[model samples]
Target: MSKAEKTRQLIIEKTADVFNSKGYAATSLSDITKITGLTKGSIYGNFDDKEEVVIAAFKFNAKRLRDSMDAAISKEETAYEQLMAMLNFYKTTWKKAASQGGCPMLNAATEADDHLLFLRDAVKDNFIAWQKKVSTIIEKGKAEGSFKVHLQTETYAYTFIMLIEGGILLSRTLNQITHLNTALDRVKLIIDQEIVN
Candidate 1:
């Protein structure tokens, strides 16, 4: 990568957590500067404005999460294992998520509503991608005879997403993992009884 590209990436990596933690509206240019250890001029030299930087940071955060999920899912052999892997990934990553200020999708979605239209769209796109990922896994499971053929894959996928994100919110707010764990447990039950053949 060129010097400018490297610098831009560095800024994004450094500020991603900040944005996730602080939200786009709450995260100021000064916060970016402080986190990145770059002068305002240097930041502006790379990003056209705060909005551009925020968009890039959101993308970076989303990709970081997606990559982690993909890696976790890839470790298991069966569709059931893959689904469990994903739920376990979230459960295991709770602390990490807390440290980063909760799930990026949840954070972005809550703050994006009536705040940043661009960010709202970005969050929407992320959820769409996520829903597709989960639905694909469920569909594969059905095709492979590991899951119930009559199961509505998309419904299950959306419900799982809703449960996970809502659990993250409650857990983060309470500073406890009980809600998140319960949500994951319910998800497991759904997979085992409702989906699994």
Candidate 2:
């Protein structure tokens, strides 16, 4: 890309962890400059303000998590297997998130509540997208006579998201992985009983 765009992306990539670890309000322009080795002029030249950079950095981190999940899910042969694979992926990857701040949706939702409309919208959209993906898999399973036709896909999708996100939050807060593992095991059990024929 162009030099300006490249610099902006570099800033986002470098500061993603900073924003996540420090939160938007606490992360300063100096932190961005320190991480990116870019001058204040270069940072301001590309982003309008700290808010803008925080939003972009959050999006960057969130996209990385989403892409990883997509890759893991795509490797499975069936919807049920895919769902299980996703939970397994979460169990393995979540430890790394401690250093990277935390789960993006959980971090954004807590920080953006009743403030930062753009960030709130982004988190909401991420949740909706995730639900839609789960629902699509459920529907596919139903069509293939794998999942029960009587199942409510939307509710199941929402519940699944809630469990996973809540699990992450609780596990992180408690500084224990067992909570996450238990939650994921429950998720796998639900998928097996509800989605597999």
Candidate 3:
């Protein structure tokens, strides 16, 4: 990468957690410079404004979480197992997530829903992508006779995403795993009773 690109990336990496924790509206340019140790000129040299930095930071944070989920899902053999792995991912990574300021998508969606169109759209796209991934797995399971459910794959996919995101929100807010665990338990029960043959 070019020097400028590298510097921009460095800024994003350094400020991603701050953005995730404090949020876009609340995080100022000063916070960015303080966290990144970059002068205002250096930060503005890379990003046009705080919005750009916030967007970059959101993308960086989201990618980290997505990569972790993908890696865990990759280790499972069956489609059902893969879905379970995806669910278990949050459970396994919750502590790290809590430390990093909760799920980036959830944080962005909550904070930017009505204010930041770009970020709102980005979060929407992320949810759509996640739903599609789950639906694809369900379709594969159905095709392979692994799942014998008589339901809309999209519906199940949406439900799963909701449960997981809700679980994470409640868990993070309450500082307890029980909320997430209960959500996962519901997911498991649904998989066992409704999806699995």
Candidate 4:
């Protein structure tokens, strides 16, 4: 990468945690400068404005989440196992993430409601992509005869996304991981009994 691109990426990496923690409305350009140790001129040179930086930071955060889930899911042998692994991965890693101010999708959705169209569109796209991934796994499991063929894979995928995202929001709001665990437990049971053959 060019020097400017590298510097821009560095800024995004450093400020992503702050943006995730502080929310878009609450986070300022000064916060990015503080975290990145870059001058206002340098930061503005890389990004057009605070909105641009916020969008980039959110994309960085979303990529981290997607890559982590892909890694964890790729480790499993069976599609059923992969599905369970995806659900369990969230339950396991969510605590560490809670300290980072919770799921980026939820954070972006909450903060960008009715504002920041670009950021909200990005989060929505992420959710749609994730749901498609889950649906594909479910379809594979059915074809392999490891999952029930009668189940609605698309519906299941949507429900899985909703449950997990909703659980994260509830857990973060309540300041307790039990809500997350409960939601995940339900996810486990749903997969084990409804999907697994």
The lDDT of model 4 is: 0.89
Backbone collision count in every prediction?
0, 0, 0, 0
Give a tens-digit lDDT track for model 2, residues 143-168. 88888998889999999888888898
| Model 4 misplacement above 4 A | none
TM-score, structure 2 vs. true: 0.94
* Candidate 1 CA-lDDT value: 0.91
Please give the distance, in angstroms, between residue 44's alpha carbon in candidate 3 and its true position after superposition.
Answer: 1.7
What is the RMSD, in Å, between candidate 4 and the native fold over all Cα?
A: 1.3
Give the alpha-carbon lDDT of every model.
Answer: 0.91, 0.85, 0.88, 0.89
Ranking by lDDT: 1, 4, 3, 2
Estimated TM-score per prediction? 0.95, 0.94, 0.95, 0.95
Error of 4 at 191 (Å): 1.6
96-196 in candidate 3: lDDT tens per residue? Answer: 88888889989999977868776876788788988898898999899879898576899999998899889999999889989999998999899989999
Can you write out model 4's per-residue Cα lDDT over 49-162, one digit (the tens) per residue? 888998889999999999999999999988988988998899899889999989998899877776777688888888888989999899999889989989888899999888
lDDT, candidate 4, at 146:
87
Angstrom error of the Cα, residue 54, model 1: value is 0.7
Q: Point to the candidate with the largest lDDT.
A: 1
How does residue 110 of candidate 1 score in lDDT?
82
17 Cα displacement, candidate 3 (Å): 0.9
Worst 10 residues of 1 by lDDT: 111-120
Model 4: number of backbone collisions: 0
